[model samples]
Target: MILDRQLLLSNAQPITATAVSTNTIDLAIARDIGIGDNLELFIKVIAAFAGGTSVQFAFITSANADLSSATVIVQTPAIPTASLVAGSEWLRVQVPALSQAAAMQRYIGVSYTVVGTFTGGTVTAGLALDREGTAYYPSGLNSGGF
Candidate 1:
């Protein structure tokens, strides 16, 4: 069987607080899925600042109301680790392929942390997804014969 998936930007709030610190944002989705399902996540980040800054991205999974137990599935490309000139948008990072095993049920989310020094700034992030199934069968001449 094949499955189609889509990831909508559920949140896009501006960053109000200032000061050098790490901020984590989380996005979650719940649905019934099976094992051997392939999942791909895409992310786009826009930075609006005048000074240098760094950001870290990660993908995680969790159960209903149990975010504390969330597990990290993948970490985004290494931090830019340089001066992010004003009005800079980084390329979208494509998360590594993730397979849903029998242990996983309903719940997937993306989390990220933005850390840097600045007077004040705003950053925006978004996510997209694609999915497929993994199943194979060998050619056969008949139901009971090879």
Candidate 2:
């Protein structure tokens, strides 16, 4: 079951360059994300390739918006060299399980890298969380059940 889904990208801009790239937009997750819920990131790629062109997507998360400290949730393999044919591709990342005792606001998003040259290379991505059937609940004040 899927819940709490939102678009992570700020716009539909196609990145067409022969270099490693990063998106200026950063996705924000509120501290209220339900504990133990599974978080996932999805990327949709549309590209028209030429001259050995290729693209890849990576999902990264940081505890701070500045991303001074960041970790990769999904390590994507570089796309295969293109045959110069337009096509669509998909990539995704599933965040590791989270514990109620270790919850915090998270910053999550994706970055794409292009090799050689390409045109009409665009990417769209989003984030979703699936509620878990069971979760840990820390003990609370027990004064009422004497």
Candidate 3:
């Protein structure tokens, strides 16, 4: 899958505590998003989350850049710390069509809610146009001729 840097909400962002994404997609300028096609959000665990009982991921929209008055458009159930391993694809969801139904906020981003203290964790999140499911390929022939 191809991820656009401009559409990225977070790039290996740390999750030591509950916080909003480092970056946000500005829907006001990128007016083409969530119009005729569905926009997908991808969240990957770059580092194993530790010292946290659980964590919930939320897709939020806000009128302010700092997400002072944010609203959750969608969210995932509280995930146990054991499941938050490195290289895990925590979430991949289609962004709702807010523009079609009603007035929409200008900024959209990701937020992490931790139930306990998180000493370590890192995540990478972004917007993607498409994503292929997880698959493994056979290793290339080694030493021996095919």
* Stretches > 4 Å off in candidate 2: 1-7, 18-35, 46-52, 63-70, 81-87, 98-106, 130-146
Top-TM-score candidate index: 3
Q: lDDT per model, in order?
A: 0.42, 0.52, 0.84
What is the descending TM-score order?
Answer: 3, 2, 1
Q: Give Cα distance to truth, residue 129, candidate 3, Å.
A: 1.0
Clash tally for model 1: 0
- Candidate 1 wrong stretches, greater than 4 Å: 1-6, 15-39, 47-52, 81-99, 102-105, 117-146
Give candidate 1's TM-score: 0.45
- Tens digits of lDDT, candidate 3, 41-107: 8889999999989989988888899876888878899999999999888778877775643545888
Better of 2 and 3 by lDDT: 3
> What is the per-residue lDDT of model 1 for residues 36-143, given as tens digits with 9 covering 90 to 100?
434344333344443435555555556633334666666656454353434444434554433434434345554545555444345443343343235566786356
Q: What TM-score does candidate 3 get on C-alpha atoms?
A: 0.84
Candidate 3 displacement at residue 61 in angstroms: 0.3
List model 2 lDDT by residue over 3-109, tens digit each.
44344542344667632223322324345544565566555554554554566666656666654455665666777655323445456556555432243236555
Candidate 3 minimal-lDDT segment of 10 residues: 95-104
Model 3 off-target regions past 4 Å? 30-35, 101-103, 135-146
Error of 3 at 20 (Å): 0.3
Clashing pairs in 1: none
